[model samples]
Target: MQETAVNVLHPLKTAALAAMLVLATGWSAVAATPPDQLLVGMNMNNVLTLDPASATGNDVVPVAANLYDYVVELDLHDPTQVRPGIAESWSIADDRRSIVFRIRSGVKFHLGNPLTAEDVAWSLARTLKINRALASPWKAYGFSAANVERSIEATDASTLTIHLPRPTDPRLVLYTLATSIGAVVLDRKTVLAHEHNGDHGAQWLTTHSAGSGAYALARWRPEDVMLLTRFDGYWRGPAKLRAVVLRHIPESQSLRLMIDRNDLDVAMGMSAPDLNALRHDPNVAVETVASGSMYYVALSMSDPKFADRRVREAIRNLIDYDGINRTIMPNYGVFHQRPVQSALPASLPDPGYALNVAAARKLLAEAGFPDGFKTTIRVLADPPFMNIATSLQSTLAQAGIQAEVLSGTGNQVYGAMRNRDFQIVVGRGGGGMEPDPYSNLRALVYNPDNAASAKLTNFQGWRTSFSDPQINRLIERAERERDGAEQIRLYQQVQQRYDADVGPIFPISQMTNTVVLAKDVHGYFVSPAWTTRLRDVYKQR
Candidate 1:
């Protein structure tokens, strides 16, 4: 909920508050935090890049979430819906292209500069300009380096306006803005001052932070540790915790041991068995929540023989969802078919695609594979991905299809799929972390453009050259629909239409993030994106 001022605070009022604070605490800014703070365990080895424009991994999302604020944000209570953040209020025009945002007055960066429309415009321009690997998620929304500078502009200091080339679904724009990349509003003065030889202060940002948020980046040493201190002038108020320490203890056993000894407050990144054991410990609490991410088995449409519609339907029928959900994913996952989770709007029913060996065999026979055929599917090097692959192999063997499971690192597996060097593969990814269903569908299933222009690295449908003229039209229509209810109806129609064709991918589960923390710790939701800012957490004391 927003707490509005009667009007902008007068300069004298701000000065009086500061004077009162100094008189009461003998400090000008804030009281010093106690030495002991909340410690959170997470992996930071992959966090080399600090520029939000170039950030594309889970490693940097949590870091940026605390270090910056976007124009709008997703509500903590209902993440799929929109909430106001830095921009206290905003409005859209009748033409639908012009979006006017009013900056929250009196907000200051951690480095002591007021946030303004200039900073918001500059940061967005930077993201579009650096549109490389980092801009992958928004690429589907038709945003590109070629057009962003002309589209997003600041009308004045307090009024920032964005002009789209065409009507973009309002929720799509808002939800997209709520993400890490869209929220990277830096301190214009501080960042510009640190600019070295046109680096846009990227070199400095890798080690220092210049933004306004609940926490400030205190220290960052690659592969070691990252610490965040509560912002002395945080707009909301002081954070509950004194500080948040993300220690890079690589081993799950080391994390477990440290938390058990009270040297740490959380033990993250552990395997299911480790968590299962920890759940029984009197001092530990394991919590699991459904996430937007999904795992699926996708077939390569480039394989002409496998192109038969019957083959696709048969593969969907052959998957033993019950077997996998019960044995392999007790705490890690839940059955899911739609690209988006049920938590979001317009999620279609499961379509009741279940295990039916007889039906699968019948389809295979119709497709001239009565005797069954051998095929190969790729999976990540991890045990879970491999376990799911092996299980599928056994089930497929029942229908006379001899399947081989190739294992390797995620890059290796996804690379093979992207390169079209594999027949089929089991993969996990969904909105990168945003729960926006349009974003997920665009990346996973929509491919109106040809493979060359598809930027198919993350587009699973394009990875297999799976395309449909009808699906593309429906996607475009849904992207421009103004009414939310109409948009949901269009999306549901798209989902059912694609399912009717037995789309190249068969979704098996919606990933459930399972985290284990100390019993006395009160932490916020561990989002589907697998990143959470620790400002809302505290120790019971």
Candidate 2:
């Protein structure tokens, strides 16, 4: 692969020209990037919005994390541990229906506005009012627009209290506050100042920011570049790097070439092959972290064919789990067949589903499809997804099932899944942002209503049109259970029931994110929740 130069000038010639120009005109060299600025290359195709109440996908997590501050944060090294952020300390009521957080003093937003408990309360209430993608968790906890104002209130200037409308485990709510972007505290005064038509500043916030964090938004051009400048007055102190430049480069080979030419300090979304090639380079270091998400093939039960339990079981048997994990998922993911992530204690082991063409054919015949049928597999036209779809197509063909691969951007693929308009989709999702088992189960398996009019697009279970009353009951019961041992037992039972009923969403692997960075870049911690903060990242000269 040939390196793509940012300009027409060669490195040495550019350096010499810069020196001559500096001597003649008193100007700094433009050929090399400054040590104080961190250059990052990543795929930003899915970053549709910056509004914390509406943004979806992992691409927006890092951006929101730096521009906003959550009340609490999960530890980078140990995600199970929750640490204070804007809130110094918090207490839960004995009834587990309410919790109060004490906001730290002297925190200031980017615009020099004071951060107070009112901002925290209003920020959370705004999510429920807007009822966008991020509001799903809050809604699941039984908080809605009707009761948000009374339920979440500012007891004082520094104390914010949240009263649950329904019974739930307070720990889960605390985890949500720590991990969800919707929970980020916004400057109430600033946001209301920009409010247009009573949107609560949703429109203005898409291109602007109002939060107390280590960095402030400098500039953002969708699908092109995002710039974050350090905030000197940040409560935790200024970030080590003066600025962060994130460039959206989708092609894996182009990212590889840029990294090799010392043009990019970090590269994300590289293919498995590109990652392998860079693994042995002394100038670059590869870092991998286990994300809480999962990679799976979902069968839409809305289709009559997939509605049959026999057909769903047959399709599960047709997947090449071992082959796909060994060949296509080196740095992408690991073999995991359960819905919950492996880090949770309630998670169950893989049920050992493997490719058995004979068994699948028998099951298909029993389902009244003696000669199999034709279908389409919708997938993103990127690494791992496309590779997984291609492998699945070949395996399904072995059982006399003719399958066609339809690949498009993340929007086209996942958008179709969200609308319940796809036959099958190879995608990645789950509620792994929090360490609790309820997070994954709620996102992946619990579906309260199956009507098309319900439009619960955020839940994968509802999107797949797969729901079991028994599984739903178990999941809800587990979430409200206070006893740790009883909760684990209930979660384990839910997984067993899901497997026995042949759920439509088949989990093949647990997702893992890998990034290649320049050796001199230090303190870059890859977070499992996708909330990676650049506050501590520094370049060693």
Candidate 3:
């Protein structure tokens, strides 16, 4: 790959630029900003709204995390370890039917209201009220619209208790709380103040935030920029950086240019080519960590040919996993077909599907498409997936299956997937919010309640209308199983069954997401869930 010009953030650049501006104009210019600021570049289009209840993509996780606090949170460095947030300590009942938290005292929302148990209860209620987006995962935990008021209660000023509708493991309850939007606390007084027509301020929250986090929202102009300022009164000390500015630049080369010129601090959401070109630049430190998401080709089982089990197996064999991982996804992806990410337990190894054109052709003939047929694939207009989709198109053609690739933003692509509007599509999405098997198993495979009311989540199974009553029974049994050993055994059984019958073609797990930053910046690591925290991050300057 050709090398790119990448440089560290120059401490004197602000002054130098200011001097030039002063020289150009007759009047004096504003003083240069202090070096204690961070500018992040990413595809901010995924963040259409900041309402934690409605946040759908991990693309906005880092941003939302800065402005909100969860009752319990996943340890950023290690998701398996649950950590405290607004709630300093928590305890579960002996019967495993209720959990109570001791809300941290003196923690103030950005609006100046001190943290209270009511805020904690109201936050979860808000997501339940919205009945969409991040609220979808709660249904698996026994949360439903009808049980909202009865299930959640603020017992005291600093005590919040939740009663489960069904018996569940305490770990499962904490796991859900650690999600990006799951246990997020909202200011009850502030949100209620903006309520109109029983909307619970869902409309107002789309553009504003009312939380007690390290940083607070300043302004957000969709598709342009989101500006945030440090909250000095944060319960967990103030942020090291004074401000965080997120710029929306879809072009990878443009982001690289900004990094090269020291105009940007960190550049995320860049393509593989742009990142590969910066690998050797001394001033640019690229941090890549394996993520919890998978890249796969989802087939609409509604298609008569795809409905055949033989055809689905043959399509799996047609993928060039080794070739794609070695050449196309170096430093960014790993071959993984198991529904769950390897970091989590019960995730099985690849079932050994090699690229065999003849075998695929035979399977195609068995499915009644002897000579193959034409189809279309929807894909995000970004790297790796788009490039991989093109490769798939080539491989499928060899088996006499002609395919056309359509490119668009994630909303356009995934929207089609959710609507079940396409025959096939190269997509990337899965549950990685917590370090557990069910988050992925339930979202990608189990769909016993796959109905219009359950569309709150983008469970791929719903799109294909795939469900197995046996698998659903196992999933619930596993959730209710309290014994650690027994729980693992049950989840592994769920994985085994899913691999044998599921129609989606999960080819690889994204190995690492690259976040390029100036070498002097510290405390930014690749996220397990594609998210980062700015509280500990600081510039050498």
Candidate 4:
């Protein structure tokens, strides 16, 4: 409940040496010297928001993950599985309305303070108050300020019980933990200490961190770098890496050069071309994994010009996804996966918007615009999306639809999407190991309130009503079903609806996060949670 104790200058020289022996001779025959250090690189600097409860941007998620610990841990080996982190094991009541967890004993925060039941209660409460800005997954779990307290109680320092409003499915709990938003726990006092700045824990978390994880934040200077040191007193065990340094390099060229020059161990946010080129090099071992994320061109359904189904369809048909796939994401496989799967209620069916000039022309004529109309498209200035946007701009020209490409950062594009300022724009949506399409759809398409809060849903401006009752019911059903099979079925049902509808947006492939590691490093776990479990990882001979 209180902030974890912070101990400085603790040495693990003896333990590290022992670990080296176990790694080399104990398990194998030939013993070799381990590399002294490991280096990693990322495109942008951390969001400078370290509070596990309040941080958002992907840039911060990785680092925050390193510094924080969660009670309900997700099983990366099995996306649907939920494992205990702070808690040792848990049980669900026969009625399924209450779940109880037996907290793991002997656990201490990075600050050296012991973890307790009170802390668990405080962390959950903090999540509810922070809501979407801090952790959308908290809301997804159906947790509310009132419902939380009435349902949650700490039986003891090592025990916690949660009572739900009604007997709901256990699957919801499982999915919720599958997200970083839910997995990120907070230090009660540290979070509460910032209550005056705002109700949310964002203000306090930005500068301070007191988690019970394997690493501690030694220094975090926004725009410059973030430095992390292994927490020797970690409950699980001492981390293998002595330190982690993350530097911000916004320019793709600079990042690539650095990686190629061996100045960096990892480079994130590279374009497909550059990534593909790296894959071919013998010295650079490149690998990609599926990320449950998607990039798409969202058109404002609220706009008068785009309000008509035919007009929306005409514009959709004009999109050349294949052309962009060929020119821009060449290394990426065809048949891009949507950010949201078809199963979610908010999903739109592809508008059958392929590269059919004749069909686009016909649809335009039927929409009473015999001459193709012109529209401006806002896009992120970054590569891949920007390049794809330009390709779209050129493709639309074929259909006599004049398209102007406007470039900006994520914030600017997001702002435009919420306001419906531009006719269309390109953006990405992801996060959550098993996102269950609704995560993407509800946030982007269905929620009317989302249209106003660019902060809530970037594609919320669209008032388009999709007539798919089956999917609508399934969405509700999936949310309640505790059985994995039933949820999967419900997901399939929604996906079918999406295939039939052919909405404006399309699916891109799920991306696997790729990172380079020094040869000395061993035992690293790369999770869909997008965070590295550096505790057991270590340098080897």
Which candidate achieves the best lDDT against the true structure? 2
**Rank by lDDT (best first):** 2, 3, 1, 4
* Clash count, predicted structure 1: 0
Total backbone collisions for each predicted model: 0, 0, 1, 26
What tens-digit string does per-residue lDDT give for candidate 2 at 1-541?
2222121101224454344323222211344345777788899888877889988888888888998899999998889888999989999999999999999999988888889898899999999899997898889999999999999999898999999999998888888998899999888898899899999999888777777777777566677766677788899988998777788889999889878877788899998999999999999999999888999999999999999999999999999999999999999999999999996789888899999999999999999998999999999987789999999999999888899999998779989998999999999999988898888899999999999999989899999998899899999899899898999999999999999999999989999988899988999998888898999998886
Worst 10 residues of 3 by lDDT: 2-11
Stretches > 4 Å off in candidate 3: 1-33, 449-457
- Write down the lDDT of every candidate, Cα atoms only: 0.74, 0.87, 0.76, 0.62
lDDT value, candidate 2, whole model: 0.87
lDDT of 4: 0.62
Among all candidates shown, the one with the greatest TM-score:
2
Model 4 TM-score, 2 decimals: 0.84
Candidate 3 lDDT, tens digit per residue, 135-219? 7777777788788777988988899898988877778678878765746888889889989899888888878888788887765
lDDT of 1 by residue, 23-44 (tens): 2222113332222466667666
Better of 1 and 2 by lDDT: 2
Q: lDDT, candidate 4, residue 231?
A: 79
Where does the lowest 10-residue lDDT sum fall in candidate 1? 3-12
Badly placed stretches (over 4 Å) of model 1 are 1-35, 192-208, 529-531
